[model samples]
Structures are given as C-alpha cells and as structure tokens.
Target: MDVGVILLTLVCYALACLLWWQLHTPVFLLCLLSGHVGALASPLWVLLYGVTYRADLGVWFDVLGQPVYSSVVIASAWFYPLPALIILYLHRVRWLGARYTIALLTFLVMAIYHFIIETIGLGLNIWSYDAAPLLPFGLSHGLISTALAATISMVLLYTVLVVQRFSLISMVLSLVPATLVFSLMIQGVLGAPFWVSLRFAESQSWVLIIGMLSTLGLLGWAVHIIAWGMDHMNWELV
Candidate 1:
C-alpha cells in the first residue's frame, strides 16, 4: 500500500465515523454495516476474476509476503456505504420523500461516483485488467461493471430495510433482481449469450461467484434480522 493511500483512507474513515456519530440512525448504521460487509466479501469475486483480470494496487508494499491491498479493501468497505447513508438521510429529512425514487437516485449517484474513481485509478496505473471485458461501443474495462456491482449490493441492503421480517428464503428471493441485472449487464457488455458465456468461463469461477453471492446474501439477511431483533427487544423492554 502507498503511504498516501493509507493516510487518505484513515482520513476518510475518521470522517465516516464522525458522520455516523452525528446522524446515528439504525438505517444509516445498517447501510454502513452492509457496505463494510460487501467490501470484505469482495475478495471472493476478486480472487475468482484474478484468473483473467489483474488489479494494480498502487504500491508494492507487503505484509508477511501478502500485498497490502487488504488495507485498501478495508477502506473501501467504509467508503461504499457513505452514498447510501447520504441518500437515506435525504429521505429522512423529506428531501427525496419516495423510497423507490431515493433508490433510483442513489444508484445513479453511486454509479457515477464509481466510474469516476475507477477511471482515475486506471489512469494512475493503480489497477489494470488482464483480458479486459468488453463494453458497449467497443470499449474495454469500462467502469460500468464496477458501478453495477456496487449498485446491486446497495439495492440488496435497501431491500432488507423495506421488509418487515428478514428470512433466508426472502433474502434468496430478493437477490433475483440484482443477480438478473448483473448477468444481463455482463452478457450485453460482453456481447455473449448467457449460456455461452458461462460455458466459456472456468468451472471454478462459477463456483466462486455462486459462493460469494450466497455468502453475501446470507450475511446481509443476518445483519437485518439481528438489527431488527435488537430493536424489537428494546421496544419490549420499554
């Protein structure tokens, strides 16, 4: 990890902590938690895709021969949730008002932000993809994929908020939209039919993607249930 990246990440983490203290809503906390969880879980996807795409993590520093990119991953977990919290705050203050409207707006904001950050990183040689995926209009390694992934993760977290009871079954079902959207986006971008695309990918990649998705879905659902249960218990005690 670059010293600069470490310092910047710490500053951002401090700011996030301060913001959380000031706002302190269950919904906001949940969003923060979800983002961190997603970030932590992203290595599954990264490792799977490493067979084809390689990311340059800015610097070559290592800990016990392990790349310091782990720090970057941890920092990203906190950073990803900031947008969702902001959108939710806007809604709480009656600025956005509608749930679906907030959801759409939040997705757009996050997608654009992801694109900008990714472009900058690529320009700085902070990361590069090997055998890059194709995008519309003959572009390669477009940031849209990352944006879509982030949006899907946030949407899944948001779905938990709208539900009265979080269950494994409900969580699995809620993933359908995100899974479908992601699959279609990748398929369209790569200009490959869905079944053909899977056939081309290594079998291990399929297993990893499936495992990662399932793990994330279960983790998000667990967090929602735990948070809700705590709230319910507090109400009962009162």
Candidate 2:
C-alpha cells in the first residue's frame, strides 16, 4: 500500500511533466509549480484538521508528530496541484461562464477529486481521519476545508490570469499568493470554526456540528463573493 501511494505520486508528477513538455504554456508551468508549492504548504492543512498518518507510508518533513495527529507525508503533495490544474483549465477554456455556475462546479469537482483521493488514501492506510467527521467517508470539515481553499484559489487565479491579463513574470509570482491563499483559507477563513470546535468541544457532537455548519455557510458566502466579484468588479486596474 505504501508503494501504491508512492507510485501514485510519481505517476502524477510524470503526467504533469509530460503535459508541460507537450504544451509548454504558462498554465501548465503554473500547474507544475503548484505541486511544489503545495508540498511545502500542505502542513497547514494538517495543523488545522484531524488526521493521522500511517507509520509505513513515509514522511518527507515531519512538521508535527503527535501520536494522535501527524503531520503531512510526502504523498500529500500531489493532491492539490491536480485540482488546481483542472480548475485553471476550466477557467482558461471558458467552459463555465456564470460565476455562480463555475463556483458551484469548482466546489463540487474539487470535493469529488478529494473524495476519490481520500478514499484511496484511507483504503490504502496511508492516512486516516481521526477527527469528528460528519460522514462515514471521512468527508469531514478537514477535507471540506481543502476543497474550499481550492475554490477560493481558483477565484484568485481567474482574476490574475484571466481578468487582469498579467504578464508571464507576474503570473509566475502569483503562484506564491495562490499557495498562500490555500493556507490562509484552510488555517484561518474556513477551517477556523471547525478547528476551534475540534479543540474545545471534542466531546460535544453538537458543537462540532455547528462548527461544520458555520464553515459551510462561509464556504457558500465565499462562492458568492467570488461570483459577485467576477460579475461586477471593475477589472480596469493595472
């Protein structure tokens, strides 16, 4: 199972590299960069959520190693970049035009993406959700936080790449902010309520429930704000 996880991560990197080699576009370059950034920034997710890593799966940099909640492993890197690539592709091609539509689709698609990834990770014993999960599939606030982060990140990407038409250098630099956006979203904006509840109300199920609900509400509002910005914001700023 550990080998499977390793192979999967390698395969993803290979695919991303292959795609970049073929297209040689800024979009694909950003995708590859996203993987590297995600690798470094992923520990923020671990810090905000309840997750435990398998002893055998392997760790690259152990940010936190408490027995109950472990830091991210090497396999964590591949997950977010793929979704970033996909969401950016959808935006680049203008597949979904309406802000709300794109927002909803992005959220659902990222959710499903993480769902499949988490399923494999959980099935293979690479990682386990030890926190208060609202669902059996371990689709807890922790997982939802990443999806929401992806969604928010997409909005920023669209603004920079699509709306503002920034130069290649600017686009490259945008990667840092893009990466930080995920960390901010997970650690502060959307993950805070659930994380606070997780810490203080471990025994109270209802408190966790409220926290999840509040997080969901914030997610919806975020989507709305992204959509509204796209619809009405003056894109004239240089």
Candidate 3:
C-alpha cells in the first residue's frame, strides 16, 4: 500500500465526513477540499520560494527592527489557508442547496480567509503583498484566489451530487481526482509563480471553459463506469 496516498485518502474522507455532518449533504465536499488544498499549498510555495529566492536579495530586511525574512518567517505560512478553509467549509457547506447564495457565501468566507493569510504573510515578511499593507480584504489577489477555488469546488460537488447519490464506493472514489490534485499541490508547494495565479484567476474564461468541459467529460465517464457496476456487478449502496 502507498502509505502516503492512503494517509491522504483518510484525510479526505475525514474532511468529507465533517463537511457532510455540518451541511446535511455531501454536495460541498469538492469546494471544501479545494479550499484546503489551496491553503495547504500556499505556505509550501512561500517556503520554497523563500529558500530558492532569498539569496537574490542583498541582505536581511528588517521589520519592526526584526530581520523579517528568517527561516521561521519563511516557514510559518504553512499554517494558514488550510485551517481557515476547514473552518469556513464546515460553516458554509450547510447552505449547499442555495446555489448562487451558497456560492456567494463560500466566496465571501474564503476571501476573508485568504485576506487574513496574506495579511499575516506580509506582516511576517514571508512575502510582500502588492497591496502594500498587512491588512486583510485589501488585496485583489487574496480575494481572487479564495473565491475562484471555492467556486470550482462548489461546482464539482454540486455536479457529483446531482448525477449520482453517494455510496460507500462512490464516496471513496469520488475523492481520487481531488486526492491526486492535492498531492500534486503538495509536491509544488514551493512559492507560487505568476502562472499559478494565472491558472487560478477567476476571470480567466478560457480556463473556466476548459475546466467545465473537462469536468463534464470526467464525470460522464465516472457515471458510466458506476452504471456498469450497478447493472452488472450487483453493487449495493451502503
């Protein structure tokens, strides 16, 4: 067994369980996972970038008379976005059936989460925000990051729920793609490039268009496979 993958699977399951309990539905799991994925990956990106790029800077920059770019400053970012997502997801998933309302609410909560993380990030001097302040809600990048991820997650979850009711096996496999994405995210946790932002930019119609098509293709295939099992294998819902 791949222990690492197994552990991630367990984590995803636990997250699904938690989200379902609060929301009384499983329709928000995708967004919840995405939000957590972003939060987890962001700090890693900051740390990797710090080590990889710190040498480029001439010397230590001081903030509040403290050298702000130290290793702790570089490393502390790992804790944000992740916890914030879990907390916000738990609160927001309960509104899953609200459609546009849920989307807006999730976006609002995630925006605040991103804002706080970026604000703290700037304060620690781990990274500089283009916004030029350690205040949350003042950064467009922050809002865009959280809002976009949340939106995608909601769509994934809603589609999954509408197409097939969750069962033990479906629930297990439902997370495979997200698990893979999370693993890739973990592997690339190092500082985000403009490309990462570009890939996630909420306004990128092309990406959204591609994502919708890809999601439909993938989901269609998955439902077909599930139907095969239901028809031929005598699979029963748990």
For model 1, where is the 10-residue window of minimal lDDT? 186-195
- Per-residue lDDT of 144 in model 3: 34
Please estimate how well model 1 matches the true structure, expressed as its whole-model Cα lDDT. Answer: 0.45
Model 3: runs farther than 4 Å from truth?
A: 1-96, 126-140, 152-164, 179-238
Question: Which model scores highest in TM-score?
Answer: 2
List model 2 lDDT by residue over 14-131, tens digit each.
7657765664545555644554555554555556666656766445554444332213343444455566566555544655444556556665776677667666667767666665
> Model 1 over residues 1-238: C-alpha lDDT tens digits?
4566567656655655665577543344344434444443343333323312235444234433334455455455445555655554564455654333344455567767667766766676555655433323443444434544454545444554453144545534443233334323332332223223333445435543443344335434533443454344333222
Off by over 4 Å in 2: 1-24, 64-77, 90-99, 131-160, 230-238
RMSD of 2: 4.7
Which residue segments of model 1 deviate by more than 4 Å?
Answer: 1-4, 26-34, 50-68, 99-102, 133-136, 156-238
Tens digit per residue, CA lDDT, model 3, 70-166: 3332232222223333533443544223233444454456446556755664565545534322222343444433333333333343334332346
Predict model 3's lDDT versus the native: 0.40
lDDT, candidates in the order shown: 0.45, 0.57, 0.40
lDDT of 2 at 194: 70
Q: Quote each prediction's TM-score.
A: 0.53, 0.72, 0.36
